[model samples]
Target: MLATPRPRSTFSNAQIAAYFYSPCRNQYDEPVPEYFRCRCWKIRKQTSRNGFTNLMQHVRSEHPTFQEEMLAATTAQTSSVAH
Candidate 1:
């Protein structure tokens, strides 16, 4: 059986921030609020509370390796920075 190809880990912090911030306006030209532009918003809009809970539950299940890589990158960045 062919293994599923992993999603690329090439997304940068700026790209992740942009996804959460969604600096672009919506279709009606209304700006999307920062609070409503994130994965949280997507979860809220796309599913019920139970579904949202389930979705989060399986995040690492679905992408365990990616999550580990992201955590390592974040930890390295935090450690490298001086107060």
Candidate 2:
């Protein structure tokens, strides 16, 4: 008997990460570290291992607009909920 084709999944098919980051696979198409070729500064900086310290620093130092907007939004949200 001939094999039948399988149906594609309807759920968990969306990947938001695919938009922000580039392909991080190795020679064998395997997953790599989270901080690979990270553009945390003017030039891409590669970390020895996976961590969020660099990313946090990048947001705090590189994106002043983001910082101000985030602070304002956070203050508004918190003050609304405050007693």
Candidate 3:
């Protein structure tokens, strides 16, 4: 018997860290630390400057098929919730 594929939403430690520590520009044009930003915030800035391309590369190299599986699972969950 074949094993069933699992739904994927798991993100890497680096990606998770980046989500919280990245800066957000405020209405006055001053950058505000995100609510969860900590000492690692500077590292996130240096790493994420290239944006999605950089992220996708990280995902591809580290997580392989996880990115595609995550997208599919998110889409499925969103559609189901909408209905």
Candidate 4:
């Protein structure tokens, strides 16, 4: 059986931050508050205990391997900086 290809794990913190912080505007074109914004699956941020918990879950479920790689990369980067 053919295995599914994994997504690239090179997404930077800036990219993830951008996804979370991307403005959610209303029909009036005004920006909705972060708490009210739907981060994924058209589910509002308020649905989760924390504004980002559900969004992060979506990432974890949708891109499990990539997320693991991202965490490893982040840890390596941080350790390198401390040296």
What digit string (tens of lDDT, one per residue) describes model 1 on residues 1-83? 99999566444434333333233357898854432343444421223333334333334354455445444565444232321
User: What tens digits encode model 3's per-residue C-alpha lDDT throughout 18-71?
Assistant: 432445566996775422333223222323444444444444455555545444
Q: Give the TM-score of candidate 3.
A: 0.29
Output the number of the TM-score-best candidate. 4
Candidate 1 achieves a global lDDT of: 0.41
Which 10-residue window of candidate 2 scores lowest in summed lDDT? 11-20
lDDT of 3 at 55: 41
lDDT leaderboard ranking: 4, 3, 1, 2
Summing lDDT over every window of 10 consecutive residues in candidate 1, give the lowest-scoring window.
Answer: 43-52
Candidate 2 segments exceeding 4 Å error: 1-30, 36-50, 67-83
Global lDDT for candidate 2?
Answer: 0.37
Q: Candidate 4, clashing residue pairs?
A: none
Better of 2 and 4 by TM-score: 4
Highest lDDT: which candidate?
4
The TM-score, computed over Cα atoms with residue i paired to residue i, of candidate 2 is 0.30
